[model samples]
Target: MVLKTAIFFVISIAAFAVMFTTMAPLTGFLSYHDVPRIVKDNNEETNWFALTESLLWDIFLVLLFIVQHSMMATPTWRGLIYNLGLVVVERSFYIAATAWALQYIMQSWLVIPDYPLWIIDTSQSTPWWWFFTLIHVMAWIIIYGATFTMDLPELLGLKQCLYRDTAWEFALICTICLTARFTNKGIQ
Candidate 1:
C-alpha cells in the first residue's frame, strides 16, 4: 500500500511537470521552441515534400493527443483500471498518459516548411499586434481561472494519493471539466 502511494506521487509529479512544461510551446507562449521557430521565421521557402511530411507529422501528433484525452476519460477505461485493483491511482495513470501525449507532441512536432498560415506580427509597436497579444494572454487567463474553480491538486492528480499521507479523504468536488464540446470545424 505504501509502495503504491509512493509510486502514485512520483508519477503524478513527473506527469504534471511534463504537462506543465510542454504547454508553453504548444500554446505559443514560448518563442524559442519548434512551433515558434516555424511561425516567426520570415523565409518563404517551400519544399513541397518536406512541408507535406511536416504537416502530416503535426496532424498525427494532434490526433494522438485527442485520442488519448478522449479514450482515457471514458468510464469504461476508468472501470478497467478500477477492476484491476488500481482504482486509487486511476487519475494518475490518466495524467501520466496525457503528459506523455503532450510531451511527445511538443518534442516531435516538425516545423511545416511553408508554415504560419497567417502572418503574425510579433512587434510591439502596432496597436493591432498588441490587441491580438492581449487577446491571447486573456485566453490563457480565462483558461487558468476556469481551472482554478476546481480542486487543482485533485485535477492535477496530486490530492488523490496525497490524501493517504494524511487522514484526510479526497473527493471529486468543485470541479468543472470542459470536454466534448464541438462546433462546425472539429473538437475544441
Candidate 2:
C-alpha cells in the first residue's frame, strides 16, 4: 500500500510539472523556451516541402491532442487500465499525456499569415492593453479559484485510494462566481 501510494504521488507530481510548463506557451504568454511572445508571422520563413507541410503538422498535432484527450477520458480506457492493475496512476497518465500533447502543439504550432480582424497596439494604447490584460488575468484567477474550491484530489482521482468528501457549499459559491465571471466576460 505504501509503495503504491508513493508511486502515485510521484506520478502526480510529474504530471503537474508538465502541465505547469505547458501553460505559459498554451496561454500565449511565452512562445517556446525564452521567446517572450508569439507573433502571427513567427513561422513565415520556416517551411519544409511546402507551406502546406507546416499546416499539415499543425493539423496533426491538433488531431493528436484531441485523440489523446478524448480516448483517455472514456470509461472503457479506465476499465482497461484497471484490468491491467494500473488504475492507481490512471489520472496521472491522462494528465501527463495531455501535457505532452499540449507541449507538442505549442512547440510545433505554425503561425498563420497575418490576417488580423482587429489589432491593438500595446505600445500606443498602454492603458487599454493593461486593462484587457488585467481582465484576462482575473478571468483565469476565477477559474482556478473555482477549481480549488472543489475536491481537487477527487477530481484528479487521488481520492479514490484516499477518500475525502467535497464541501458542497463552497463548491456552489465557486460555481456562482465562475458563472458570473464568464457572463461578465461575454458581455465585454
Candidate 3:
C-alpha cells in the first residue's frame, strides 16, 4: 500500500511537470519581446531569470500533482469520460472567469501599457481570442477521445467521480496552463 502511494505520487509529479513544460506559453507567461514583436509595439524583452523561475514553478507543480494523483488509483474509461466532461466544464469556467478578470484589471489600472496579462497577443494576423478558442476546442477533443475509450473500475461509484485520478490530473493540467500563461517566455 505504501509503495503504491509512493508510485502514484511520483507519476503524478511527472505528469504535471510534462504538462507545464508545454502549456506555459498558452497561458501568457511569454511576451512579444521575448521573441520578435510582430504585433503590439509595446513589446518587452524576455527575462532570462524567468527560465529559472519556470523550472522552480514546474517543480512545485509536480509536487502538488504527486499529492493529488496519489490519492486515487487509475480510472477506467467510463470514469475517464466522466472526468473529461468535468475537465471541459472546468476549462470553460476558467476561460470565462479569467477573461472577465482581465477586463476588470484593464479597467482598474490607469496608464496600463499594452502588456500581456491573462491574454496574450501572439501575432498580428489574429487576436488572442482566436488562439484561445482553438486551444480550448482542441483540448476538448483530445480529452473526449481519451475518456471515451477508458474502461473504468467497477468498484468506482458515481458519487466518487470527483475523486478519480484522471480528474485530478486534468485539473492540475488546467491550473498549470493558467500559471504558464503568466510566466512563460518566447519559444527557446
Candidate 4:
C-alpha cells in the first residue's frame, strides 16, 4: 500500500506539473507581451501584484498537497476537496485584494486622464471576461464540493480505493470545462 501510494503521488505531481507548465507557456505564447502590457496599461500595478500573489499561493498549495499526500497519505476525496477549498479561498483573497488595490491606484494615479471612474466599473456588470472568470472560479467550487461529497460515502464504506484512475479522468473533464469557460470558448 505504501509503495503504491508513493508511486501514485509521484506520478500525480509529475503529471500536473508538466501539464500546467506546458499549458501556461503555450497560452502565454499567443499573447505574451500583450497580456502584461494590458495589465500595466488597463490595470494598476497592484492588479499585477495580485496575479503574482495568486500564483505564489498556488505554488505553495501544490507543495502543501505533495507533502501532505506523501507524508499523511490523505487519499480520500474529501481530503482532496478540502485542499482545493483552501486553494479557492486563497485565490479569492488574491482577487479581492487586487481589485481593491486597483481601485485605490486608479483613484490616486489618475492614469487615464479622460476615462472617469464611472466609465470603468469593476462590479458584476464589468465585462464578459470578468464574468467568465467568476464563472470558472465558481465551477471549481462545485466540482470540488461534489467530488468531496461523493467520496465521503466511499471512504466510509471502504468500498473502493479512494482515487482510482477514473477519478483522474473525471478531473480531466472538469479541468477541460474550467479552461473552456475561462477562455469564453465552447468545449470542442
Best lDDT goes to which candidate?
Answer: 1
The C-alpha RMSD of each candidate to the native structure, in angstroms, is: 8.3, 10.1, 17.9, 17.4
Q: Report lDDT (Cα) of residue 85, candidate 2.
A: 74
Better of 1 and 3 by lDDT: 1
Which sections of candidate 4 miss by over 4 Å? Answer: 1-61, 74-125, 141-145, 148-151, 156-188
Q: Over the full model, what C-alpha lDDT does candidate 2 score relative to the true structure?
A: 0.68
- Write model 2 residue lDDT over 1-188, tens digit each, in one string: 67866776777767767776776667663312222244557656654465677668878988888999999989999999979877767776887788888887777777544433345556556787677777777777787789899987756656543421245346658879888888946743
Task: Report, for every candidate in turn, its global Cα lDDT versus the true structure.
Answer: 0.70, 0.68, 0.43, 0.42
TM-score of each: 0.67, 0.66, 0.27, 0.22
Top-TM-score candidate index: 1
The per-residue C-alpha lDDT of model 4 at residue 176 equals 87
Ranking by lDDT: 1, 2, 3, 4
Q: What is the overall TM-score of model 4 with all chains considered together?
A: 0.22
Error of 3 at 19 (Å): 18
Superposed by TM-score, candidate 1 places the C-alpha of residue 59 at a distance from the truth, in angstroms, of 1.3
**What total of clashing residue pairs does each candidate reach?**
0, 0, 12, 0
Summarize candidate 3's per-residue lDDT along 32-116 as a digit string, tens digits. Answer: 2233433344466655465556556555555544544443323553366456544322322222333333334333333213333
Report the Cα lDDT for residue 29, model 1.
31
Q: Which rank order by TM-score, best down to worst?
A: 1, 2, 3, 4
Query: After superposition, which runs of candidate 3 have C-alpha atoms over 4 Å from their true positions?
Result: 1-51, 71-122, 127-139, 149-156, 159-188
Name the candidate, 2 or 4, with the larger TM-score value.
2
